[model samples]
Structure formats: C-alpha cells, structure tokens
Target chain A: MVVDHFEARLVKLARKGDQGAFAELVDLYKDKIFHLAYRMLSNRHEAEDIVQETFLRVYKSFHRYDDKQKFSTWIYRIATNLCIDRLRKRKPSYYLDAEMNDQEGMDGYTLIPGDERTPESEYLLSETQEMIHQAIEGLPAKYKSVIILRYLQDLSLQEIGDVLDMPVTTVKTRVHRGREFLRKKLENKVF
Target chain B: MDCKQASSLMHDYLDEDLTHGQAVELKSHLKDCSACNERFKELEQTEMVLFAAIKPRSITASDELVDRIMSQIPNQRKQQAWIGWIRKHPALTAAAMFLFVMLFSAISLWESDDQLVVKTADLDQVIINGNTVTVPSGSTIAGNLTVENGKAEIYGDVQGNLTVIDGSYYQASTAHIAGEIKSIDQALDWIWYRITDMFTEVAYK
Candidate 1:
C-alpha cells in the first residue's frame, strides 16, 4: 500500500514531462483520492473536483518536492489542506438531491422508490452517515484535518503529523478528541 | 505498565512504534485488566469502521492546468535560462531587488546612529530633566509610562504605575494620581536625603 522507490522514479519522470507516467500515477491514486475527497467533502461532485484540483497542484509543485520526505505525505498534505478549506466554508446542513416523485418517497433527505427495493437498513445507515458527516462538519478545522488523514486517508499518526506540521502527540490527541466528539453525536443514531 | 498506563499507551502500542519491552509490558497489563482490554476492543473496532469508511473518491484533473503547463514548457526548451526567469516572476524579482536594497541600507545605517535619530518627546509631552522624568502636570499618556533609573512625578491621572527605581519622588499637592507609586529605593541614600531636603527645609521653615 506504500509508494516505493519504483513509484518515486515514475513520479520523477512524470514531473519531467512524461505524460504517460503522469496519467498512470493519476490512475493509481484516483479512486483512493476520490473517496478521500468524497468522505471529507460529503459531496461526490465536489470531492471529484478536489481530486482533480489536487492532482493539478501536485503537478505544479512536483518540481519543488523533496524526495527524501515521502511523496505520499506531500500529496496527502495538499489534499487534506484543500479538504479542510472546503469543510471550513461548508455549512452544517447540506442539500442533497432527493427525488420527490409519487413512486419514490423521501427518506429524510434521500429519495426511496417503491420498486427500488433499497434495504431499510441502507436508508437508516445513510441518514446516520449524513448525521456523522454533519457532526464532523461541526469540528474545528484542526481536528477535522487530523481525523480525515487518520480515518479517511489511512495515513499513520506520524504521517498525519507530517502533513499537519504537528507532533505525533498532537495528531493523536486531535484524532482521539475528534472521534470522542463523533461518538457523542452518533450515539443514538448509529450505535 | 499498569492498566492506566497500558490503556493510555494502547494507541501508540497499536502503531507498533513501542519498544519490545514496553509493548510486552502493556500486553501483560491488558491480560490482567479485563476492563481495559474490553475498552481496547471497542476502540479498535471504532478505528476499523472509521478506516473502512475512508474511501478515496476519484477526482478529474483540470484540462486547463495541463494545457497551460504544457504550453509554457515548449518555450522553456527554446531557452534554458528562460525557465529561471519564468520561475522568478516579475513581482518576486522586484521584491527581491527591494529587499536587497533595504538590507544594504539597513546594514549601512545600522553602523551609523545619526540616521536613526529617535524622537522621544513632543513639546506637549513630558520632558526628562536630570533626576526627574517629569510628566507635564495636566497631560495624558496614550501608552505606557516608564521611569528608568530615576523617579516620575504624577501631577495628572496616570493610567499605569509610577516607578522610582533606586530613587523616589513625592507628588505635588495639586496632583490627582490614579495609579500606584512604587519605590524600589532600598537605602535612604544621599540622593533621597537631598530630594527630601527641599521639602523638609520648606516644612521646617
């Protein structure tokens, strides 16, 4: 799961105008970054846009990168910073596109069709997920950045600290504190 | 490690960053403490669920960025020095030049104090005369009031304290002082006696 020297060489090549290698690198991280952006932003479209923007930023800044430091940390830092900025501007209650047709009923903010046969548990879980998203939304940017890097991006505590430019203790504290807060928010609904 | 330390360290322990001895100690503690062990399980599960939920969403790159970078690149090959110039944008170059001049002037002026004349007082402001740093009887201090190595006279409402370091001053009868008067004069030296002499002689007479 870790990017190795082989990938590092490929990144170096990509930075030096190897379009094919650049494309390959994009293909490699797209899904993971897409999901990261999606979970962080909660809007699929915005997440996708962030992923795209993140890649562009990566390309532009690649020349300035220090390979001694892990490239993954560098890119993940960029993505996490972007996500935090978006989250700071985002409001607590988001408007999802829900269908209001006769066949499909509204499940909270999500639409459910009569013939769609989506499991009841799925809808409930979605609502709970939405609530969790809002709860995370309420957290300060510092906590959210650490939580996202730890949980969503699957970065290690050390990696999270590297990205946040904080110590490992600070990252752990933020992650623990953020999770405890979410635990309180998701207590009745998800638990 | 006891249960308390073991549980507190479980997070670091899970990172596999602990030394063998520490990890083993925590493991031994966990075996004895069922409550801490149970909490550890819940904590691990929560970590798992959160980790599993983190999936990277695919993001599409902007075509404009690629095109823009690609376009500038061809020009770079035509002239190698051009890349350096391009990298150092006009604004940055100007800023660098300005900084260079500023630093040069700063260093030059730093050795000479004539150009660094600091105006300490205005006609309306307080003036320091020998032993006394006198405040204009009916003036206001917009900022901090300081008396260094000498005493201060508070004829007006001082917002801060009046300090007499190694010396003292008495307020005039017309004074309306608001702040405290601090005297750090340990010994009643000749200076204090001389200052007292003027008032004492007047009082005796």
Candidate 2:
C-alpha cells in the first residue's frame, strides 16, 4: 500500500497531543478499520466495538509505536488482534449460546430489520451476499482473516504479512489455502 | 504442470501474483486438463462473488465513534511539554547542556583560583615589581599580553591585543596599541573572553 505522505506529520502532531491532528487521523482510518472489523467479526455491533477499542488502544500506546513500521500496518495489526481476541472469546460459551440462538430461530441477523426492497433482483442480490457471508463465516479464524484481508481489504500478501507478523511465504500459503476453502464452501451456491 | 501445481497457480493467478512465465505455463496446463480448468473456473467465480458482495458495502463507523475516542484520551499534563520538546530535539538539548556545563565549570574555576599571573611572549621587555607589571616607554611587545590578579602600566607600544583579568591597566599618552584592549572584571566576562579567545584561535588556524 502507498503510505500517505501527510500521515507521518499527523502522527507527529498527534504524538504531541494535538487533538485535531488525532481526529484527522481517526477520520482517515475509521471506515477502513470498521470494514475490516465488520468482515472479520460478521456483526455490526461487535465490529463497531472493535473499531472503538482499536483506536483507544492506539491512543494509549502511542509512546510504544516504532516509526520504522507504517502507521497503517501498526493500526491494522491492532485492529486485527482485537478482532481475533473477540473471536477467541466468542468460542467457548458464547459459541454455544450463538448455536442455541440459531436453533431457537434467532440468528443474529433477525435482530436487525431487513431493508425495504420492491424488486426481486435486489432480493436476489442480498441472498447472494448472505450466501457469501455465510461461506466466509464458516471459515476457521486463521483462513477468515487472510481471505478478508486479501479480497475484502485488497491488501498485498506482503502487506498482510507485515500486519500479521508472518513471513511472506507463510502468507502466500495461507491465502492459497483460504481460497481453496472458500471455493469448496461456495461451490454449489448460485451467484 | 501437474494438477496440484496447476491448482496453486490458479490461486496465484487470481491474486495477480503470478509471473508471466508461470501464467503461460498455467494457461497451457488448464488447456490440456479439463479437471484443472473446471477447478480454476470455480475459484474465479468465488473471487468474483467475494468482490461483488463485500466491496460495495463500505461500512463506516458512526460519527459518535470519533467523539467517544477523543473523550477517553486523558488531558496531556502541562509539565510534560518540555519533556516532549526534549524528546523531539535531542541534539539541540545536548548542545545546550554542554554549553551550560562549560559555563558552570568556567565560573567555578574563576572562583577557586586567585593568583597573580602575567603572560607575554616578550616577558623580557616587561618589568615586574610585586603585583605590578610595567611596559617601559619606547619598548615594543611583539605579541598578545594577558595579566590576571595584577595591575599593568603600559607606557610603550603593543603589537597585539592586551587583556586584563581581575585587574586594571593604565596606558600613558605615548602608548600605542595596534589591537583591542579588553578588561575582564567579573566571572561572566571572563567566561565570555575565554570563549571568544578560543574561537579566535580556531579561526586564525
């Protein structure tokens, strides 16, 4: 990714307690981080929480930032870690609770009302999106991140490696495996 | 390439990470193998769906999120500003610190030392009696003259500068000085004189 030239100046100003600069930085990254978190967690509310917590942690740990790393890499690493942590916490009892809710005809999506649509084509489009989301949500956390970062965020394999602190070769392998997993899960679904 | 290798290349090709040579090889393999060709099509379809479904959403955080984050940041203490400044300009701080130490040491040395000293390359031309030094009339000194903790009475010519520290100089009407005469009566003045003298020596060299 092309690093923003003004980003370093903003980071310097923010480090010195320029709240306006910090707010500009937040504005620059808010949507990207939100979209990454939303795709990773597949829940709007939890994704929003991840976004808030990621920036909060970034603020608290500004002193620890090493300038050698790109600010985007640093922030994405924080947001990715937060999403992984939330996913891990959702594993034991929360996982069971979610499954139970699904059995009780209360899948998480039902809580939010669907958008009004008069055209059958729009309904089909939403269904395709729903199918794609389900296929991705079924992936293991490891594969899910690589797939979302690769296709959804369009990060280069090397950039993803830096954000995830993995070797480029390892990132390539995960991306391949993740793609294969998606292909298998999405084989029969009509797009 | 075999089917397994072809399968991996297809993924690389979809990601646009394949080299031209590898792409050519994968293309030939897919042409020759129906199974791999079918599999490649499926992978392509999956990627297309992924891009079509997700990229359009462009989910954004609500406006209150930025405000909430700003609210959580504790106010930066006023006293830390200097610390931040020092952190930002370490080289400047170090230079200032070095100058301060040099000034302090010069003042302490001045306070600790009280002795009568006279410096002149042509000391033979100067007459010393007790704490008083005299350059008699019509005798010329070739170089700079420095006197400390004493009195200097000049009735002759000086070819270079004359400096008096913690002392005084009296020049007669006939005395001719080709250079500046400086008197240092305080520690601060002494320090300034030493700094300028050092710089002058460096500049001359």
Candidate 3:
C-alpha cells in the first residue's frame, strides 16, 4: 500500500511534466515490460524496442490516463498492445492452427535462436524449460497474452481483464484454454 | 466426483481460485481416482515448469536504452508544455482567439467597405457632386454631417460634430464649426465609433 501510494505520487508528478519522476517510473517498469515483450515476441532486440515504444507512448499520452485505474495495468496494456502489434506484423496470417502445422516441420534446435545457445545459457534453461518456451511461442496470440500475463506477470484475473479490456470471465476462460493447450502440447513429453 | 467435474476443479485449484470446500472435494476425488490423480499431477508439473521458465529473467534494460528514451522525451515535453499551457488557461486562450478573430474580421470588413456614403440632416444646404460633399460659401448647416469613403469640403458650417470615416476632410479658411470635427480612419477606431453610435441609437429608441 505504501508502494502504491508512492507510485501514484510519481504518476501525478510525471503528469505535471516532471522528467525525473517519469524516469523513476521508467526505471520501475522497464524490466517488467521488457520481460513481457520478450516472452511475447521471443526476440530480445524487438522486446527492447517494445519497451522503448511503450514508454514513449505512455509519456506522449499521460493526459489520457485515468487515475482510478491501476497504473501498472495501464502500462501493461500499452506494452501488451505493442507486443501484439509486432506479432501481427511479423505474421499477417497468424492463425491459431497455422503455427502448429509449421512447428511440426521445424526441429526444437532450430526453434531456439542460434546465438542464444551459449553453453552456460543452455545449462540454465533445461530441456523442459526450453520445450515449454517453444510451446508458448507457438500458441496463438489470444491465448498467449493471457497465459503470459497470468503465469509470468502473476497478474490477477481482474488485473488481466482490466489490462486486456476484457471481462474477468473471458480472462478466466482464456487462461484455462491456454493452459489446456499447453498441457496438450507438452503431453507425452517429460513433465 | 466424476472425472469431468474433477478436471474443472483441478484447473480452478491450480489457479488458486477455488473455494476451500471445492478444493477439499477435488482433493478427496483425486485420492479416490488414479487417472484423475495422475492427470492433476501432470497439470501441476506443467504449471511449475511454466513458472520456472517464465519467471522474471534478470533482464535489465541497458543504460543506453534509458538514455535513448530520455533523450526523446525532452522534445515531447516541450510540445506538451505548450499544449498544457493552453489546456490550463482555456478561458484566456479562448478570449485571445476570439479577440483575434474579431479584429481580423473588422479589418477585412473595413477594407471591403469602400462604397461612398454621405449623411446630413440638412442636405439641401450642401452641394453633392460625385464622391465629394461640399458646403458652399455662406451656407449654414443645422445638424451633423458624416461622410464615409469620400472627401468632405467644408467652406461654411454651423452644425454639430462633423465626422469623416475612411476619408479626408478639408476645412477652408472661412469654414466655421459649432462642434468638434472627428476623423476616423483606422478600423479599430471605426468599430469603436460604430459601437458607440449603436448604443446611442438604442438609447434614443
């Protein structure tokens, strides 16, 4: 609660053209937004780009932000929307079933980025973790966002709804369906 | 409990969204059903693995990224400050805009209004020829004289204030006036005169 009050104060100060306050906000959410974008896009450079663009947009449109809503939710919504936009641009015909067919022909080694497979990094990400990441990368954008927000960001169902501008029931259904999809994808493999 | 009810409860349990009673029921069912128990364990393992894989990486944005974002912000802040000033002083901004528009239109109207007009209560006492109004020698006018967009020559006058708008007035050496002569050439002065004239007309009416 004290942190929430401090964050609200920072938002108020930033809205009044305080650059230092805005920098503090950026410092606070930069890694969180980057992690979200990285999970969604599976690309480090693009994730960084998303982080930059999200903060730029947030700074540009501070007046539109409603003080009643959670600032974190609003920032997450911006980051999520930017990540989705980049995903859609990467694959214009991005359908739920389309990527599944494409994944079958591709090996897991090829699915992982070539430059990211350092020996230490490979040791850090176990086979199961790598498989889970690949499965998540292949999920449809709709399910992908909810799953990441729920499991990764640890947002509540209500916070996810607010961020996605959807009802809590819809968020619940998506999270369930997303986990079920992951369960099916990882079925018959090592738990 | 049936397998279907148990599966739904299992998902709810994983989310930690289930009521305590529902969780207890699901727990009891898992104990009784081997297949449901196995399925719940796999789901729980998947949840755990997912949490491990997606847990916040120690990924921090580089100082260069912060510098890039901060460098871009000063430009936007400058523009926002200007817009914010207008937003903060809406009434002053609106009044300034209104005054600007009114001044602009008044100037345009004055420039476009070039038709010659002459008014006098005693028209018979003056000679009107072309765009010039002349009070001939030894002629006495009883009332005020106003001329617009035309020259006014007063040789002899015994009248109220003589007003010339957007035109020059010539008073001969023999000219005599009972009141002050006023010449309005600027658009702003003409507008002020028109306003006062309207108020006086309204009062008289």
Candidate 4:
C-alpha cells in the first residue's frame, strides 16, 4: 500500500492540531526512533526517553517542517541530532547503561532472553554482542552514527547522509572507516 | 588495478556502488592479491558481525511516553494553531483585513456629514455659503481657480485650471473652460495641493 499517502494525510492533520493524527504518527515512528536511539546510546531507558523527546520536539516544530522533504527524513534527522547531542554531552567517557548494569551485576545478556540455546553458546553470543557494542561505543560519535544507521537501522548511504546532514561520499567514507575500526578491535576475538 | 587503487575502492565494491568495469577490475586484483583480499574479507566479516550482533527486539513505546508527550502538546498546539491558521489562510486573512479597513473608512467618511462646493470665481462675482463657493453665470475668471471644501459650477469662462477640494465640478452648456478641471477627495491629496499652493503664493510674493 501507499503509506506515504496516509502519512502525508496524518502530517497535514497533525499540523492543524489533531492529537489523534499525531498519536498515529507517534505509533508509526516510535519503534524506529527508539531503535535508533538504543543503537546510538545503547540504553533502553534513555532511548525510550529520547524517542518521546524527539516526538515532542517534532510536534512543537511541526509548522517548521518543510513539505518538500519526506517526513521520515525529517524525523530521522531530528532523532539522529538528538542522539548526537546526547553523545557529545557524554564525551571523554560515554558509558552505556548496559555497562552500568554490568557493574551492578545484571549483565545485558541475562536480562534479554532469547531463543533456546546451550548455556555456553548463549554466553558466547552475549559476550560477542557486548564486545561489538563496546567496539561501536569506542568510535567517535560521527563514525559511530554512520555505522549504527547503516547496519543497525539498515538505511541506505544516501538516507544516512540525509539524516546526518552529510554528503553521500562522506557517509560512505565514515562507514568504511567505522567498519575498519571495528574490525581492528575484534581482530583477536572469535565471532 | 593496482593493490593501492583496489584498496581504496574496496568499500565501494562491498557496497556494490562501483561501476561494472571498476568492480570487474577490483575483482581481478583481489584474485591476484591475497593481502588485499584478506583485508576485504575481514572488513566484510566485521560488517556481518556488526549487523548480527544488534539483537532485534521490539522496544515498545511506553504508555507514559505517549501520555507525557500528548500532555505537553496540548498547550503547544494551542499556541501553534493560531500561527498555523495565519499561515494556512494568509490571503484570506489579508483580504478580510483590507475589506474591514475599506468598510471602516467608508463609514467614517459618511458620518462626517460635510458637503462642499468648489469653484473658480472672480473675487467680485463669487457667492460663498459657509463651505460652498459658486461662480455667477456672467463672471469670467482670468487666473487659476482653487477652492477647498467646496464645489465648482462653471457657467462662466475659466482662463486656467479649476481645482476643487472635497467637492464636485459642474459645467453648464454655455460654460467655456480654457484649462483642466480637477477634484481632490482624499485628505492627503488635498493637503499636498494646499502645501504646493502655499509655496506658489510665497514664491509669487
């Protein structure tokens, strides 16, 4: 189905102060934005909070949203900007809430249950997941964002460029460098 | 392609962003160059692991998140509604305002209740009734004639332009005008005519 038609209608109604339309918008994008924030910040609670804040800001500035661009691009830009801001504010030592939970004796792997597997296999998978998360966390915010949006969110290079306000070539370069950085970090570790 | 060039284009190849010729060239180089090939393999593996490692779990939007956002929006939406309304109907709003000003000016002009007559007349042959000035039928005015708050009835010959302020001009069939006739209805035009007239009188004096 043509979702853009429906989304555009919702945006039109939302612009005119339709709460129900805006709520529909929230329902549509909440998970996408929440996932993006979670990947960028690696904290479920904070990601959820950021998603709420992102929508709030979107609602407040709905009048400023240019109709020339797709609504998805605009919302992604807002969410990515918020994530980048939160990342920058935590620079020098950006710690994920998962790491904090680890310190508090509740590791991320145990908290999130998954399909049935051998204990050893599950442990290995969990550790590898944590390690990958740390490698992504170790990247600078710019490269880290490109990697998250590219791989985790499965956005195209052009879409990532739009969200990051960078050119396509620049986004490609970041993706390459970000992958190389993660590769070097995972050199000795088993996948 | 040489190893150095192939290395630089490795990401483009993996992303499938290369031209067919470039991809073919890079592939040939990779077949011969194990070192570059290993590096490409490692990069590809890292990307695969990166994608795999991100657990796909739905993070449901919290009930409070919607509630909190909705709560904050009511006040903001109220403020934005006014701004949005203006943006949406700028032409309509401007037209309405223009119509209101026009109606208001018409009503005010009607309420003032002042009737005026202006004419060109010789000093010896004009009749003045408060705001009305009339030129007698047999009189001839030799110079420019200007009247304020008055109407002009030209049964006689006017040698120059007959200008009237806030009044009308009526010319009899026997009237002969040597120059133009003009009526000033608006306040600004009347004021401007008076100012120029003052300057003309000052210069002549």
Model 4 chain A: which ten-residue window has the lowest total lDDT?
A115-124
TM-scores for all predictions: 0.51, 0.61, 0.68, 0.62
Model 2 chain B: weakest 10-residue lDDT segment is: B73-82
TM-score of chain B of 3: 0.61
lDDT for model 3: 0.84
Q: Order of candidates by TM-score, top first?
A: 3, 4, 2, 1
Better of 3 and 4 by DockQ: 3
Instruction: Give the poorly placed runs of model 4, Cα more than 4 Å off.
Output: A91-125, B58-61, B82-205
The list of candidate 1 runs beyond 4 A from truth reads A1-3, A91-139, A183-191, B1-7, B17-38, B55-205
Interface RMSD of each: 5.6, 3.8, 2.2, 3.5
Top-scoring candidate (DockQ) = 3
Chain A only: TM-score per candidate: 0.74, 0.83, 0.85, 0.80
How much is B194 displaced in model 2, in angstroms?
43
lDDT of 1 by residue, B78-112 (tens): 46446568577988888988998976775564334
Candidate 2 C-alpha lDDT tens digits along A84-164? 999998857665554333222133553557722122122334666766776776677888888888877888999999999
TM-score of 2: 0.61
**Interface RMSD score of candidate 2:** 3.8
lDDT of 4 by residue, A95-163 (tens): 555344332213343256772212222333467776777777667788888988888778899998888
Candidate 1, residues A134-191, lDDT tens digits: the string is 6655566778777877777778888888987889888877877777676556555665
CA lDDT of every candidate: 0.62, 0.81, 0.84, 0.76
In model 1, residue pairs whose N, Cα or C atoms come closer than 3 Å (at least 3 residues apart or on different chains), thus clashing, are A32-B56, A34-B56, A34-B57, A34-B58, A35-B55, A35-B56, A35-B57, A36-B56, A36-B57
Cα-based lDDT at residue B148, candidate 1: 42
CAPRI-style docking class of model 4 based on DockQ: acceptable
